[model samples]
Every structure is written in C-alpha cells, then in structure tokens.
Target chain A: MIGEYITSNTEIVESALTQSLPPAWQIPLPLRESMNYSLMAGGKRLRPILVLAAAESLGGTKEAALPVACAIEMVHTYSLIHDDLPAMDNDDYRRGKLTNHKVYGEAMAILAGDALLTHAFYSISQAHKVHGIPAERVLAITEELSAYAGARGMVGGQAADMLGEQGITKLEELEYIHSHKTSDLIVFSLRAGAHIAGASHAQLQALSQFGHAIGLAFQIQDDILDIIGDEAKLGKPVKSDEKQQKVTYPYFIGMEASEKKVRELTSQGKEALLQANLVHPERLLQLADYLMKRDH
Target chain B: MIGEYITSNTEIVESALTQSLPPAWQIPLPLRESMNYSLMAGGKRLRPILVLAAAESLGGTKEAALPVACAIEMVHTYSLIHDDLPAMDNDDYRRGKLTNHKVYGEAMAILAGDALLTHAFYSISQAHKVHGIPAERVLAITEELSAYAGARGMVGGQAADMLGEQGITKLEELEYIHSHKTSDLIVFSLRAGAHIAGASHAQLQALSQFGHAIGLAFQIQDDILDIIGDEAKLGKPVKSDEKQQKVTYPYFIGMEASEKKVRELTSQGKEALLQANLVHPERLLQLADYLMKRDH
Candidate 1:
C-alpha cells in the first residue's frame, strides 16, 4: 500500500514538473532544452514526495502543494548539475547517463543550473497566484527555502565537504557536513509542505525533528549502499566511494554500525511524526520504513 | 547634487550589504569570504541605487527599501561572479580587483555565486519580516523578481548572448539580447521599488518605460565607452570589445548613430518619468542623464 502511494504521488509530481516550464519556443531554445534535459531525467522524486506526503499528512490538497514540490525538485536537480561540473566532482555520469555538463558543455550547464535555481522561487509564488494559497504562507515558505538552501545551510555544508576533502579525522565534522549538505533541504521540503497546509508551530517543529532524523539516516544509507549494493539497481558502480577514498559512515564506524544507525534514526523519525497529531500520517510513517530498508 | 545623492545612497547600500550576510563565524569561512570578496569589490551600485531611487520617488522609506535594494545587488553580483568563471567569460579581474574565481578556486567561486543568488530572496523576505512591508506586496515583488531574473529574463538574455557569440550579424537579434539581458533587471528594479511603495498601475507602467529606454541606452553607452573612454577610469581595458571581436552597438550602427541613440533614449526615459506624477522625479531624471553621459 505504501509503495502504491509513493508511485502515485511520484506520477503526480512528474506531470506537474513537465507542465511547470513555459513551452520551448517561449524561452530561448537552448536554455529551455538544457533545463528540461536535467529536470526530466528521472530520479526517486524523494524530495517532492516528502513535500506531498507532509502536506497530505497535514490535510492539504496536492494541487496546492504541487508547485512547491516541483520547485524543490528543481533545486535538487540544479545542485546535482553543479556538483557534477569538472571543477567540482568531475563526474561524467549520474544515474547511468551523461551528467548535465557532459551533454550541455560547462557554460550552458552553469547557466541552466542558475536558471533552474531562480525559477524555483517563481514556482513557489505560483502556489499563491494560481492555486489560491495565502500570500503569508507562501512568503513563509520562501523565507525558509532561502535559509535552508543558502550559505549557512546546504552551501555551507558543501563548502565544508570540499574543505574537508583534504583529510577528515573527526566525526563531528563529518556529522556537520551530512546534516547541512544532506539534511537542510530535506528539512526545508517538510517545512515548506507544512507551511502550505497551515501547520501550527508545534507541527512544524515536529516535522523538523523528523526531517533531521530521516535525512541523516537517508545519507547514511547511501553510504552503506555504496559499500555493498547491486550496481544495476543503484544505477552506478558500487564502492565508488572507496575508489574516491572519501570518508563515509562505514569508514568512520563500521558497516554494521551504519546499518544499525539507519534503523534507529528511521524509527526515531517516525516516532517524532507520530506525536505531531497530524490528520493522516500513515503514508509518511510507511515511507520512513521503506526508506530505511530500500536497497537503492 | 545628483553626485551627492548617489554617493550617500551608495554608502547606505554598502553598509547594509555588509550587514546582510551572517558573520564570518556563522557561515563557512571560505564561502563567506568568497561571497564578500566580490560583493564588496564595488561597482557603481547602479541597480541597487535604481531600486532606492524609484522607491523614494514614490514616497517609500529608505529603511523599507534598503533590504530589497541590497537583495538586487546580491543578484547582480552573483551574475558577475558566475559570468567571470573560466568556463564562462574567463575574466580574471573585476572592479580593479581579482575576480572571485581568481582568489578562490573555481569551485568555491561557483558555490559563492550560488549562495548569493539564493540569499537574494532571503533578503527580499527580510523586507517584510524585518522592515514591515506588506506580505502581499512582498509576495508580488518575489514573483516579479523570479520572472525578471530567471530563464525568461536575465538568464535568457545571457544564453542568447553566448549563442550569439558565434556571430551576431542581425540587429534584431542583438536587440533581443540587449533588451532581455540588460533591460529586464532594470525594469524589474523599477517595478519592485514601485511595488514596495504601493505605487499605482500607471506609475508602474511609467517606470517600465523609463526602465527600458534607459536600460538599452545604458548598454549602448557601455559600448561607446569601450571605444572612447579612459582605461583607468573604466577599471578595464578599452577597445576590449573589438579585441574580442564581440558585436556592439557601434559595430553595426556606427559611433555617431550609437551616441545619438543613447541621448534620445535618455531623454525619453526622463520624459516618461516626468509624466508619472511622482513625489520626487528630479533625482531619477538626473540619474538617467548621468548614466547616459558616464565615461565608465
């Protein structure tokens, strides 16, 4: 039942994402094509799904949350594009296909990433203009978005990660990197959805707690999978982390400890949400379980 | 008098821009340093000044408009940093100082640009949260901001410019690039200031006219200055455009025609603002005149 729920919501998000941009002729052809190329490349749609599930749990309609969902997905896609640049990770492949820079050239890819980032805010405002959400709520979501996505959050984490690449001997530093780089956007996604649904202070706080727990768990799981997962299912080579000599949860502790930590954190995340008094949270609860156990 | 007005306003903007970012300890050191490096390097402060001038022209407080002004400057600075990347323009100097990518590596420069762009909306929301702007107006500014700065606006123009670098033989295509690239943000700054001041539709329309005339005029003046201006005053080499073999206003229309067009557009811009029935149009009118005649 949870699998079907995710599949259905993923479909909704994919369709909305397609319709978000103007027609090709409307924007410059190359800019529109570059943006669409990465945006349409398939993913688990995890962030958008978190948005919808959080909104639905708080008694909000999908129509009202869809734009914000698509917006977060755009941000995620743009980050991936920039991260894959030659100056950054230099990865030529993502999800078993050519990365954005690999196909569009670095210049167009950079501008395309930029355009997508700028358009995310445009999408949030649409939630108010087109879907009739309150302006105050939309404004709140926009504030949270910049706070989480900007320097002190995701970007800060990225900087630390890059700086730490020289050598990371401390676990606190690694945690800091994971929390900011991986978890900030997750927190923003949940909090944005909650804002759309007019969630109370307590509920918003609860979602933040849940977001942090699951977000860290999700990254730890990625680390674990990199050590021992099927290459085809993962859509990239396993143990590439080892190949890169990058530090990971398994490296800091052990594979058994990392897997055990994922279970604990996932349970803690679900428990936090359970106490929030949401109208419907079964899907979200099931999502935590599914995420913790997933192979890919 | 216009010189004093710009100088005073520039100081106010500079102070606020400094205060806008979190302190060095709060954000990652490298990111904070990189963002500040380019942001504080200093240009004419033209866009932010435009925001404040338009707002003040319509009876808005400098305090209320200051955050938005700073936000727009952040957006402009981010564009410059990204534009200066080796992958983009390969520029190594800006405002007589090393470019962000020159001092910081390409990776941090890119992240700094990303952070600045993200922080811009954060600063806009601050106009409401800290400055008491109405939520609806703030929301409207946010929407217009994304439209003007995103794929359809500045980024679209940039893409077209890059594509046209192969060869831009047609005046129509050059105009499209200039209008979208140069004019949209100017138009947005005027309109955003109008929104902040609660200006009427007629006032907004007048500002749009003023913005377009002056925006294209501004670009033409840059082209003319590249040919005739002092390298020391401009902080960059003259005839650099011809050196790059890049297309310019004078390249096609001839120097005399380009100079004439700048004057005509500046007069038209002043004329439009004069018709708007503003509380204070003298400064803005003087600004258009100053911009058209500037050597730098």
Candidate 2:
C-alpha cells in the first residue's frame, strides 16, 4: 500500500525537500553545510508526502501544499537534530550516520537546529507568492504553523518528554507526550494542507480527526518496532527504550494489545476520510495501514 | 546618554517586555518559567529600549514598537541562555544569579532557549492584532529579525567567536566576531523600530549607519570593561575574557587604542543621527556616549 503511494509521489516529495533549502551562497558555508547534512540524510520523507497526499486527496494540486510540506519536514529535521544533542537523547548515530552534534559539535548542532526551525516559517510565508492564494489564507497558514511548532505544540511535547524521562510514568503522561511530540505536527501538516486547498470547514474537521488517529497509530507502531525491529534496518539501536526503562505503548500495554490498538486506530483514521467523502482516500488509508504495520 | 534613555524609557520598556509574554496558562508552565527567569533577570534592557526609542524618535507611539522591542529582547535572552551552557561559555552565573541551566538543568535550558527564539517571531506576528500594523510590515520585520538572529548574523558571530578561541587571532577576525556577535542584533533592533514606524527609506538607511557605529562602539567598550571595570559593577567576572584567552578587541588593538576607537565610533554614530535631522536625537546620542564610556 505504502509502496504504491511512494511510487506515485516519491519524486515530488524528494524534489520538494531537496530544493526547499536556499542556495549555498546565500547562507554561510558552515551553517549551510550543517543544515544540509541532516536535511539530506536519508529518511522516508513521510510528513511531507502525507501533506501532498492529503491535499491531492482533497482535490487540491500538489503546488498548493508544497511549501507547507517542506516546512513540516524542516521542523521534523530540526527536532531530530536537537533531540540527538548531548543534553537530550544523546544519540551518536541517526539513519546509520553520525548525528548532527557528533558531526558538527554541540554548539553548531544547536544553532543549525535553531536556524532550520526559524527558516521553516520563512518558507511558509514565501508560499504567498503562489499566484491565486488569498493573503488571509497565507497569514492563517503561517499562524497555524507557528502555533504547532511553538510552545503550545512541539516544544510543549519536548518539555513533557524531558520531564517524563526523569519522573514517574503514567498512561496519561505517555499519551500527553505522544500527542504533543509526535501527533501535533502531523495534525498541523494535514490542517495546513486543508487550509491551503480551501477545504470546507466540515472537511477540515474530518481531516484533523484523521490526522490525530493516524498520528497516534504511527507512534504506537514505533513503540512496537523498537521492541522487535532489527538495529541495522532501523538505522539506530533497537530496544534502547527497554534498556533505558522508558515508558512506551508496547511497554505499558503489552505488544499484542498495542498491535490491536494500532489496527483499531488505523481503521478509525480511514473512517474519518469516508465521513468527509474525500475524493481519493486510498493513499491516506494506505498510509495509515502502512504506519500501523511497518516493522521499522 | 544610554543611562538617560534607559531611565526615561525604563517603565514602558519593562512593562512591554513583561506583558509581551503570553500568560503562564497559554504557554506550558515550565517553558513560561524558563522564559520569565531569563527575561526578568535584571540587566540593562538596552536592545528593547533602543527599539522603542528609535520608534518614538521617529514620531511613532511606543505601542508601535513594543512587540519588536520585546522580540529583540527575547532573541537576546535566548542567546545568553545558550551561551552560558556548559558546551559554550560554561558560566554558572549571569546577572548575579544562577544562569538558566544552573537553575533549570541543561535540557530545560536548551528547550527554554529554543522556545524563546521561536516565540519571538510569534510575538512579532501578534503585533498586528495589538498595534494595528499591516501584516506585510510585520512580515518584513520578522524577516529582518530572523536574518539578524540566524546563521548569517548573531549565530554566525557566535560561531566565529568559538572558532577564534581555538585558532589564530587577527584584528579583522576580532572585528568580524564582535560585529556579528554584538552589533548585528543592535542594528536589527534599531532597524526594526524604523520598520515598525514606517520610516522613510533614507531615514532607515541613516538608522542603519547609526546602529552599526554604536554596535561596534558598544563591543569595544565591553572589551575595555573586561580589563578595567569592577566585577561587582559588571555583575559577571572581570578579565574573564583575557583569562580564557578569547580573542577580544582590547587584546587585538591595545586597550588605549580600543578606547580611542570607541570614542571615534561614538562620534560617528552621533553624526549619522545628526545628518538625519532626527528629533530628540539626544536619546540615541546619549546612548552612543554611554555605550562608549560605560564603566560596566
């Protein structure tokens, strides 16, 4: 299912992420080097692809969601860079290569993350140059992206994650962390696409619900994979959470139950699209299924 | 002169900075706490006041520049928090109190700095609602602020400083470091005020020149202060720069020459404002003199 979507839109997503960055001369060499290092690192480009898929599914062209999709990926990359820092996750490798801090040193890594995150908004605002979009919609999209990436969203999730690592773990705590850390950006990506495509309010509501369910399912699948996936395939150590005694869905609910929960959530996510009468829901539904069933 | 400006605008600047932040409830408590800690820690509110003073000097109301002022300070505070981290300057104290990392662990400090920087733009965008500024103007202001704070500006300066600490020291290198590290934000603060007030292109150019001169002068004076000022008066260690063997202006060009350089720069800064025929030029002239002649 995922392979079909990838085959169809893979070039679009790849080109968008690769070209999203400014020209080399515009940015200082070292800074550009650090930013490009992590951005060009291999990954699924999942968030951005989802953005395009959702927009197309809503009967909008890929151009409408291109900037937003790129911005989401930039934010995601920034999170990964910061998360790998010594003070945070402290991982030495990511995607089978040295993490940003390990390669660029701690200070530059931090600044690189910061620069990328700040630049993401600039990218979104530039999307206003798109010929037909209304100014109000551009402003609204910019505002929504900021809220999701700022304290109320991703940063809030990070703060909770840090605190959670050091404090007692509860089901509520895990849910809060997952929702904010992982789900908020996903919700923002879909909502932003809908807003750009001029989706109706009811359609937006359904899309948002679809985003939330699939987002949570994605995290749950991650938890399951961490317990059983191969390190080489994952491109990072597996079972690190178990070794660290970190709380996760699989750890708390048992693997079998966690798998069942993912399946249920995936179905609900697909139901949201059906309710909205989305024109082409196959890609999104398949994405949900792929997320729930992926090994790594 | 800076002292007079600070004294006269102190109340307005302080009130704006405090109120610019969202209420604790809107932001997560931990993020709010960290932001407030660095923001409210007593220091010269030089940047924010410059922003307001520049706007007022151009016949705009204090309200016009309030958000830009607060955003400049937010950028400043974020830099300070990050600079004080163990991987950076490793300072345990700032403004005579435990630094953000010292008070709140390294992880929270990192997150706090990230949150503040991201929220700074959010604050700028909110200016439209608060002050009835046009979104285009706000976007321009944000773009300028981002350029000053990002890799090409303050962060670039910081990287230069870090590299200079470990390599060959030249007068040009020292100038580059100070210009980027200290002056870029100052230039941005003044330009932001001009942008907010919708100053003429000519007036903005003059403000840019004035900002550049004063920024360099300010850093030269800081270099001098490290060698000559009392530690208690400065609120941080004295001669610490020399002790650490960090490249500094006074070290590159003897203390006497550095002082002379500051006097020359201050006169040039005042001359820029004079050429512009700005009303209430005394506020900025006084600031230039104060920056060049400050004891702390």
Candidate 3:
C-alpha cells in the first residue's frame, strides 16, 4: 500500500523536480550536465514525495509544495554527493552508479555539491513566487528548512557522527548523532509540508511529533538493513556501515531490541498522525509501517 | 580611502557577526565551538561590510541590512573553509591560524562548512521576518544570492579555476576564472545591498556593472599582492600562489600589464558608480581605488 503511494507521489515529484530545474543556457555545459547527473540519478524521491503526501493529507494542493519538495530533494542530493567525497564517506557508488566525485573528479564534485545546495534555496525562494501562495508563508517554510538543515540540525548531527566514529560508545551519544544526522531533515520534510499547507498550531505540533517518531524509526531500519540486507537490494554495498565502524541502534541495543524499537516508534508515529485528525492519515500510517518493514 | 571605508565597515560587520552567532544550548558544545572558530576567524569582512555600506548609502537602515550582511559573510566563510579542505586547496593555515580541517579534522571541517552555508540563508530568512521586509523582495534577494554563489557563479568560477590550473596559458581563460569567482560574490554583495534598500532597477544595473569591474579589480589586486605584498602586511604568507603554481593574473599578464589592468578596472568601476547618483559615492569610489592601490 505504501509502495503504491510512494510510486504515485514519486512520479509527481520527478515531474516537479524536472520543471524546477529548467536548464540554464548561461551555465557552462559541463556544469549543467553535472547538475542534471546528480538530480536525475534515480532514487526513491522519498523526501519530496513525503512532502507532497503530507501536504495533500493536510488539504493543500500538491502543486503548492512542488518547489519545496524539489528543494528538499536537492539538499538531500547535495548531502549525498558531499558525503561520498574522498574526504567524507569516500563511497565509489551511489544509487547503483558512480558517485559525483567518481565521475567528475574531486574538484568538480565539490563544486557540484556546492551548486546543488545553493540551488536548493533558489528553488525554495522561487516557490514563493509561484502564483498562489502567500509570500510570507513561503518565506516561513524556507526558513524552517534552512534551520533544520543547518548548524543546529543536520550539519550538527553529521559533526557528532564524525566524532562518534572515533569511539562514542554511549547509547545517548549515538542517538544524538542519529537525531541530527538522519532525523533532522526527515522532521523538516514533514514540517515544511505542513507549514505550506497552513497547518494549525495544534496540527503542526502533532505532525512534529509524528515526524520525530518516524524519523528515528527510519534510521533504525537503515541500521538494520545495513546489517541484514544484500548490496544489490540496498543499491550499495552491504555492511558498509560496519566497514566504517560507525555506531548504530543495533550496535547499542541487540538486533532484537532494535527491531522492537522500530515497531514501538512506528506505533507512536501512527498515533500522532491519528491524534492530528488528518484528512488522509492512512498513507502516512502505512508509510511508517512500510519504513520499518522494507528490505532496503 | 577605500581601505578606510572597508576597515570601518569591517568593525561594524565583525560585531554584528558576533551577535548573530550566539551560542545555542541545543547544539553540542564542540560543534558550536567549531562553528565559532571558523566564523570568528579574522578576515577583511569586505563582503558583509559592502552589504551594509551599500544599503546605508542608499538610505536603508543599518539594522535592516545587518542580517543580510552577516549572511553574506557566512556564505563567504563557508566557501573559504571548504576551499581549504584537503580535497580542495588543502591549506593548513588561514588568517594566520590553523585552517578548519587542520584544527577540527576533515569531517568536522566539512560539516562546519556545510552548516555555515546552510545557516546563512536561514539567517537571511529570519532577518526578513524580524525586519518585516516585503516577502517578494526577500525572495528576490535570496534568488540572487543563490545564483551568484551557485554553479553559474562562484562555484562555476572555482571549477574553472581548478581546471585552468591544469594548463591555461590564455589570458582570457584566466580572466574568465577570476571574473566569475571573486567578482561574482562582490557583484552579489553590491546587488544584495541595493536589493534590501529597494534601489531602482537602473541603479541595480549600474551597481552590478560597478561590482563586476571592482570585483575583477579586487582579484587582480589579490593576485598582485600574492607576488609583491609583504608577508607581515598581508597577514598571511605571500608568494604561496607561485608555490602552488596556481594560474593567476600576474602569471598570465606579467606584473606591468597586470598593474595597468588593475588601474583600468578601477577606473571603470568608479565610472559605473558615477552613474548612480548615490548619496555618498566616495565610499564606493574609494573602495575601488583601495582595491587597485592597496599593497595588501
């Protein structure tokens, strides 16, 4: 059920992303090519699709959130490209193809990531001018996305993750790392959608809680998949996390306990969505369940 | 005269930047520290100061442009930090202090750069809300900044710079590299300031021209300084460009021709400013002269 929703929303998101990134004639041809390479690299498009789903469930037009959806995906993609750089994760493959650095060399890879990140905001600000939405609300959504992705959020999480790899064995420390590195963007994705939809304070608060629960569950499932899933199925090398010697939910708690935590978090996420009395809560609920149960 | 203006504006910009980056309790203390380390690292603060001066010169309140000014600096600082990373320029020292990667290690440096860049836009959006600026103008400024800093602008320039280093004997290629890189930010700085001040389109166009000329002049002077300036006066090592074999204006144009080009560009910049009818054109004209004439 969640797969069908994601599939449909993914189609909407891809079309939106393509339109958002209308080709620039002035940019060097190679630069444009690199931008397209990273943007068109196939993935689930989960962040943007979730954004659209959340907006639609909250009774807003998906079109209103399209630029934002694309913007979030741009940020996500930029992070992935940078993460795979030799200085960072050093991965050779991403989404079943050579990473940006692998194809473009280190210098161009860095520039490509920088371009994507900056363009993400460009995409968001452009969304403010997209005809129907109040500019103030669009500005507000942009601000929230920036905050969630910046120092106090995702970047901060990444810093902690780097430090943790040197040997942070405490469970709290590990959780802190994951919350910032993985969960922050996830939470931002949901809140950004809700913000565009003009969700009430109560509804926003409920979505926040729902986002927090599912975001953590999503990370836990990633941890599990890293251990048990095949490389081909996961679209990257399996046990790569182990190779990195990074801490995970299963590292702190046994695999069984981690699996239980995923179930508990999924339930909490669904409960929060129900409490919000969303118009179409089933899609979100099913997504939470599927996130915990997916093979990859 | 331009040195005096930049120096005075630098003081104001530094204080404003300090206030803008207050410590947050929620972020891990070390992450916060690393952020402060890179942000507080002393540099000219020319870009942000240009932002404030441009806004104020056009009769906008200093308070109104303060956040935008800081945001510009944040973007500048992030670029510097990332540029110094091992995968990029691999510098061990910046501003007479250990570079971010040298001090914080590679991963933290990467994250620090990412955080600063992301936070910059967030800061601008927050400032827009606090200042109660029209959302359309805010959106416009955001879009402009992104375009200037992204692939088509600064990043594009950097790519060309990197590739140009491989073997560019052509003076035009060298000029193209610096024009996009250093000049793009300067252009953005001037335009962003005018943007916040609600300058006329004609005025914006003139400032852009002024920016382009001075921006190129600024880089030319920087290239000149790298060869001829005193180490103590420059506040960093001199002649490093020669050591790196990095393509530079001096390398392509020779000292005499490069010096003449600087003078020509400075005059063009001042000429552009003359069309503005600005309240105090001396600040800008002096800035151009300073860029051309400064030893450091």
Q: Best lDDT goes to which candidate?
A: 1
- For model 1, the stretches where C-alpha displacement exceeds 4 angstroms are none
Clashing pairs in 2: B1-B286, B2-B286, B2-B287
Q: What lDDT tens digits, residue by residue, belong to model 3 across residues B88-162?
A: 888898878899888877777777778888878877885578997777777778888888998878888877777
Taking all chains together, each candidate's TM-score versus the true structure is: 0.99, 0.92, 0.94
Instruction: Give the B-chain TM-score of model 2.
Output: 0.96
**Candidate 3 to truth, TM:** 0.94
Can you write out model 2's per-residue Cα lDDT over A241-284, one digit (the tens) per residue? 87877888977789899999999988998898789878887878
- What's the lDDT of the predicted structure labeled candidate 1? 0.92
Q: List each candidate's DockQ score.
A: 0.88, 0.46, 0.67
RMSD of 1: 0.9
By DockQ, the best candidate is: 1
Task: Tell how far residue B289 is off in model 1, in angstroms.
Answer: 0.7
Question: What is the lDDT for A255 in model 2?
Answer: 89
Better of 1 and 2 by lDDT: 1
For candidate 2 chain A, the 10 contiguous residues with the lowest summed lDDT are A130-139
* Residue pairs in clash, model 1: none
What would the per-residue lDDT of candidate 1 be over residues B1-296, giving only the tens digit for each residue? 89999999999999999999967887889899999988999899999999999999999988899889988999999999998999988987877798999999999999999999999999999989998899999999998989899899999999998888868999888888898888999999998888899999999999999999999999999989889988888888778777878899998899999999999999999998988999999889999999987878
- Stretches off by above 4 angstroms in model 3 are A19-24, B1-5, B22-24
Higher-lDDT candidate of 2 and 3: 3
